[model samples]
Target chain A: MTRSGLRGLRAAALTGTLVLASGAFAAENPIKLGVLEDQSGDFAAATIGKVHAIQLAAEEINKAGGIMGRPLELVTYDTQSDNTRYQEFMRRVLQRDKVDVVFAGFSSASREAYRPIVDQFNGFAFYNNQYEGGVCDGHMVVTGAVPEQQFSTLIPYMMQTYGKKVYTLAADYNFGQISAEWVRKIVKENGGEMAGEEFIPLGVSQFSQSIQNIQKAKPDFVVTLLVGTAQASYYEQAASANVNLPMASSVNVGQGYEHKRFKPPSLKDMYVTTNYIEEIDTPKSKEFLAKFKAKFPNEPYVNQEAENSYLALYLYKQMVERAKSTNRDEIRKVIAMGDVCMEAPEGKVCIDPKSQHMSHTIYLAKVGADHSISFPKVWEDIKPYWLGEAGCDLTKKDPMAQYTPSNPPPKP
Target chain B: MDIATLAFSALYQFGDAFAFLVLSACGLAVIFGMMGVINLAHGEFIMCGAYVTAATVHAGLPLPLGILCGTLASAFVGVLVELLVIRHLYERPLDTIVATWGLSLIATQGTLILVGSTMAGVGTPFGSFQVGAYSYSIYRIVLFVAALAVLAALYALFNWTRFGVLARATIQVPHMAAALGVDTRLIYSLTFACGAGLAGLAGGLYAPTMTLVPTMGATFIMEAFVTVVIGGADVFLGTAPAGGILAIVKSGMTSWQGQLFGQIGLLIAVIIVVRVLPKGISGFVLRERT
Candidate 1:
């Protein structure tokens, strides 16, 4: 049979099933939640934990009899660390599995790839990653730290603790390079000079010279943005050289993976900014930690993406309970109107009324010699940098909200 | 600018990028030049090599053994490609490109379905042996030097060895070599495997610098195309050094200038050079003076 005929048959079958089960759909139909992420590529370690955590959340929710008497079904698709795969996965989830909600795509690149498709189909995508933010869409919610929230909170604190001079490094990509630009602005505005910045390719080695330059510049602190193991390698080189510059990272730089470079001395006294801590002073965090450890005891280390996905599913449950339906339009409306606040352990988080993003609290923690991410401080009231001073009003020229205007325009 | 500082800084950025680019370019050049097979699935061959290295290392195999098995298996996979798919497409360039591209997609998706969608990491098992001030991952530097050695050996193989001479003769005078009782058809398979083996070698070497993803092979393939085309696909020696120079300049420009402009400038340069010299400058220079 031809493909169109197969598609037609499937669509007809879908319509017939929906019509017959319309009355029982709310209670009996499986409310499929698509958890799509970079599964087989560069981001698996950071994101697989999230997929497993979401599964755990689903199982626990299902055992508790799910939201509003319906079973919470979780289906996962790995974007294979490619943008094209993300689109394909989204299609398979929406059309094939016919999921009600999805935690689709991580990283700014994947999110950008998914936004238009989600918007076109009138579905919802809860993006859970810290990014250089300038998002404007109703069907999307930015759960991770936007530039203003993550940078403003850390930069001033680092400057006060270390000094004004800062050195920057990041992966050479759309997200990392833009983030480095923001860090430079944040440091300079707070009475500091950017002492040379480096942008390594997506996967490059040999940081000897970048290390030497940063050491020679004598920067009081470093705002490192490199991700994956390159993030770990850069830190290892620095720590070994005894470059005691107080460092901060938007990426999960000094996690267990980085510390594994050598035994201990290679990755000590490093810091990272994230939303969830394995040791947060909360009952929920404690309970979640134990449960997560039981599930992922072998890979006991968890990153923010894992926590974000778990919380998102639970939040979807709460919203489903509050709204009393699985209507994508209604959920989209409820999220955009910002009437729902999750029982977030990091703190109570609600979607920003206008941006349609969650108001997540960002935390700064230092990795100790034993490889524990120690959060000594936390910042609430997180907002994007665009809403702050450096935000450019490009809405006029970019009336459709597709193009972005540069802040502090080009240096002649 | 102080040329030493500028060149040194550029070289610092250049080593990793060039190592990666040249590793694949060297392989593709050898295969395409010697065997005349398009081999679009070459990147996947490299990817399989890295994963084999990772899996073997994870399975409690020695690091050196893992590297050895990975490259051998990669070469084996190349032979498999030669046997299953490309064996028929020897005379069809477009068909070979299409078939290999499909194979690459299948391999990528198959990897996703089997291993998972997350990135797997490989490490240097022997640990680090650093010099005084300048530190390096012993494994990666070892790979870098190994790549050079392999290139030198390959050069000597083609220039000084009987197999190389036979292979060269097969290319230069296929009809004459066939009349002289040379098994020209067998050389194609052998050369294809050797080229794929080099890609695997590059992948195994690069496994430590960053995470190994199925898509990684594709990224390096793009670099391979750039280097191979610029270096002179027909000639191995001149193409590699020129490609290395280009890659370093491309990566180093991002540090001094910005990523966007640096890349844009590199693109423009590549376009202009290609326009003025279609066969590539290296190709023009490498041509016989007579």
Candidate 2:
């Protein structure tokens, strides 16, 4: 062999030893969990608690000896409530940092924006916000409550307590549109009539016409699926206009904590179906809230989304431990095996393998005249039945599609 | 419902729509219509007013006093803004728009950084009265009256007061007004201040009805701009009638269909008016009178 060849062989041998040493070192290395969420922007106020919750969950897991005796390291990015930022950060986290798993996206638009990128990288992610149902992706887990989970509990209670006639004012978007469809279906199934339905575009603050129309229709109650800060003005406007019809919503006081934010009687008599709220009066919930407050002393409220975010980390940790590996495919396989339950602050929440959605307890919370929240009723362990009914068996096949009422999977 | 009740509902809706348009637009009317500066920070000024009013009310002040404080505060800030930023960009209309837009972003973000995103909102004070099956807010009626009061106040300020005459002369013919021994610079500052104060007043009036947020100003901006645009440059001749017409179109379409259609109708009406008249409703009216 030439002298240059001997030098090359030595260099290769040295590099191989270094690689072997690093490969062993990798097991001791911290697991990188990417958190992509809106920390500052349009949805910042509503989502700040969520980010804090993730942080708290990570800290707790690290304190308790994280997944597989490896410390959990968070790689968080603020998407700033912008869709483009979601895409950019998703790619950065998955392709660049190569996070083991990502918990990202607040809005459906945001989720959809970064979802394709996740698929491209074959990445696993969790969307931890309540939304319109029917996202069946093999690479993602939806930890938030879907329409079937929320409306199935809410609409029936609304119809039973209030009357048969319903008026729905939904935000004009995918979440709102699809949720409105669910409202219609649930209302009809419960033998109730939809008096009027209006899809108010986002950023529409004025609702005098809407209030007037609601009065004209004279529904027993109004089902408001309004989203965003601007749309929250509907409650204030409706109160001022003295449209005294009891309002029921899946998205209002729970996520935004509108009752706590707005003054007395604005959200009075509002029936909100939620998985969690700051006012959840349970030992576990209180303990979790106290811990959260101790950590994030300035956080406004522990919203439903925050609870979902908090529990999602624990869920991920459980999957990692059960799978005995942080490999995405192994974790996904563990998820597909069946129920992976966790004792969440809200209640016992379990992951449904068939649809990659959660089955959890949902509460019917009512806002009193003084803006206090009270749980009047609750449905336990409500599975995400709509997707399964729509033939979205992720175990059978991953269509990687979102199904709406107008668009469903072909009947099996 | 009875015919009388139906008519009352329609009338109430018209008043509500008119109040919203006029109040939101009045400040922009003075800044954009009179001074020819498209003050994009108009919304920020409104936000300032709302924040101050809400904060003051929460701090144990009466609602009216809080509103007065909010207006004065905005006017003071307007003067400062005029002296610092707007004065430099007066000759550059497009630059003024950009500068004010920048100012708006800074104000919004600054408010966000300072006070966080949301604060507790003041409750709408007045009770509602039932007519047939429908109930309407008395505060909304108060809003309508406040809108008219604001317009009348503006009219009196411009048409009746000595400062109004000077402002009018200064805005219309600056050199002529300057040569005639008018302090044109002071007039410009005062006019801008008044415009901002009116915007603040709109914010104060509506603060009770809105969810007080850093970006709450955006909700008012679209209507304000459209109203000012359709009203034309002549604030006195333009704004009230423009508000009235737009209110009619908005309320008509709203009652005919829903708020979505109402908004669509308002935009469509703006398009048609801008297309035909080119200048605006006031321009058409001015031409007819001429």
lDDT of 1 by residue, A334-360 (tens): 665556787675777776655655677
lDDT of each: 0.69, 0.90
Model 2: lDDT equals 0.90
* Candidate that would win on TM-score: 2
Per-residue CA lDDT of model 2 for B146-253, tens digit only, reads 999989988898899999999999998999999999999999999999999989999999999988888889888988999889889888778899899999999999
Question: Per model, how many backbone clashes are there?
Answer: 10, 0
Residues A4-23, model 2: lDDT tens digits: 99999999999999999998
- Residue A263, candidate 1: C-alpha displacement in angstroms: 7.8
Judging by lDDT against the true structure, name the best candidate: 2
Q: Which candidate is the best by DockQ?
A: 2
- For model 2, how many clashes? 0
C-alpha positional error of residue B88 in candidate 1 after TM-score superposition, expressed in Å: 2.4
Misplaced by over 4 Å in model 2 are A1-30, A69-71
